[model samples]
Target: MACQSSLALGLLLLVSCVSWSSATDYTVGDSSGWATSVDYTTWTSGKTFNTGDTLTFNYGSGAHTVDEVSSSDYSSCSASNALSSDSSGTTKTTLKTSGTHYFICGIASHCSNGMKLSVTVAAAASPSTPSSPTTPSTSPGTTTPSTSPPATTTPTATTPSGSMSIGSVRDLAVIGLGGLMGFVLGVF
Candidate 1:
């Protein structure tokens, strides 16, 4: 009975972790939205964008326009030949690929006054590598090395400071819910 309960608890935890690891939605400029007097560069400095995440631009209608432009257009702050433009005061763009996406306001002198945003999206989540194994010793002062090759580890990516990851928050919530369910099932 004890072993079965442990197994069930472990499975529940695994399922919770897997379900929370997914895409997230980010509101640009937070409450300030896409408008003048807001420093978009500083606003997005601490966020880690990933492919499939959504970027939402919120602003007043007719006051500003969101234009998806090329790197050249972004550099020049020119929206005359933008790839796409939206003036609905709210725009949502899903990061379809792992690359840099540039956006700017088509209004006069808006892009020049820090009304542009450049988001760099990373690739989808890859399988995490296990920890490296330590060398074993037979005696306290004497050790024998094995013929096995050294383990290679991939550096884990960390979210930026002052920013919360959507997955991390959801993961915690899922874990708590799993624990509650386990307790109700007498698996605690």
Candidate 2:
């Protein structure tokens, strides 16, 4: 019975870790919101976009329209061939692929006036996995130590879209604690 419980506990821990991965939601133009006056190019320059991440455009009602367009349409500032359009004052687009995405304001000359955005989406990051330590040779009567360099990760830059949530972190903590408790109980 104890062995069965221990196996179950370990399985739960592995599942919990796998399910903790999440994507981020970014608001375009930051606190300024999405507007013609905002420099879309500069706004997106320093940001890292990835597949599964969402891009939200917020604007005043009837002030602007968000249009997903092809590269040529975006460059030419033409909405005639827009792939999709939204004008409810807010628009959300999920980046589903690894490539370039172009958005423009189709309100008259907004695009020409610089109300355009282009983003290069990278592939979603793979789930992290535990790595084995490196073992070095040691002489007899001496203890050999295993060591490894810490893994380096590139931080993602995020813009505030108001109201932050730590739900994922909280969930992860709860899952981890439950797994630990289960393991302890099974062992003893």
Candidate 3:
């Protein structure tokens, strides 16, 4: 009976342990934000926040704090601290959900001094599937016009009306208007 009880407990614990893997592995300010979490405002390759991924801040300094700021794209910080400046900030917080998350260092107005960062969680795709772009039919039910000089069809030219072609009338009218305007200006 004891052996069966032990086996059942082991199975239960194993099942619980294998429930699910963490979707996010955010780090504190890396020496630089290259492919990882950066301080201030940026992310690298490994720091990519994806859909359904919750980011947890890690501090490296004792004087650092994650300040949630107001943002239009993503949600603000979840919490802040006056002593989270450890290069590996410990007073960390998790991003509520996958979206734009803007945070800054909140220490004696450190943010106003330009200590901030932003993260955008883009939608994730399945590894076994490919995503395709949606395209709308823009053609007006017509085919592309051939570019061979429009087939070089011989176009018979048409003559203008009133015995005056456009070229002569355009020039004559311009000269006549100029003369009339000059005469009026002189009289004035």
Candidate 4:
């Protein structure tokens, strides 16, 4: 009985950790896909990208090339000295650093027509020790209200379109295995 309980707890922990660490996969341009005529600047707005996240560019195989370039190349729509280039219709780039990354379409006139994208990735949040709560100091028998209003912020949500990422598939596989293990252990 104790063995089964421990197994269950271990399975729970595994599932939770997998879910928490699963990185997001953003489909560039959403439904419009990686192409000209799409406003990439607006597409990237309001989205908080983090390291470990992936950006998938979907386009016609021969129609366009996904080129990873420096800021100067992106600004000038130059693919002559691209850091990386792919014309395989689909390109998947994993953000490994915490800084801005730029991409542009290598096809002539494509990038100038707004087929360039620059995304700023933030470092992934890590687990930290909780800070102790502080109580406001007040004078004896004196109640003072805060002079300033509380600050509020709006969170942006992004949904991946068209396909599921490899990470998502792996997460599901882990969860399924955990369930199977639990079932077999229960029978034993």
Sort the predicted structures by lDDT, highest score first: 1, 4, 2, 3
- lDDT tens string, model 3, 31-62? 44212223445344445565555445554465
Question: What are the per-model numbers of colliding residue pairs?
Answer: 0, 0, 22, 0
Tens digits of per-residue lDDT, candidate 2, 121-155, equal: 98755555556544566788997555556565545
lDDT comparing candidate 1 with the true structure:
0.84
The lDDT values for all models are 0.84, 0.81, 0.50, 0.83
Candidate 2: which stretches are off by over 4 Å?
Answer: 1-18, 125-188
Q: What are the per-residue Cα lDDT tens digits for candidate 1 across 138-159?
A: 8778758656867777565576
Q: Score every model by TM-score.
A: 0.64, 0.62, 0.40, 0.63
Q: Which model, 2 or 3, shows the larger lDDT? A: 2
lDDT of 4 by residue, 85-141 (tens): 999989999999998999999888999999999999987555455555455789999
Q: Name the candidate that leads on TM-score.
A: 1
Summed over model 3, clashes come to 22
Any idea what lDDT model 4 has? 0.83
- For model 4, the superposed segments whose C-alpha errors exceed 4 Å read 1-20, 126-188
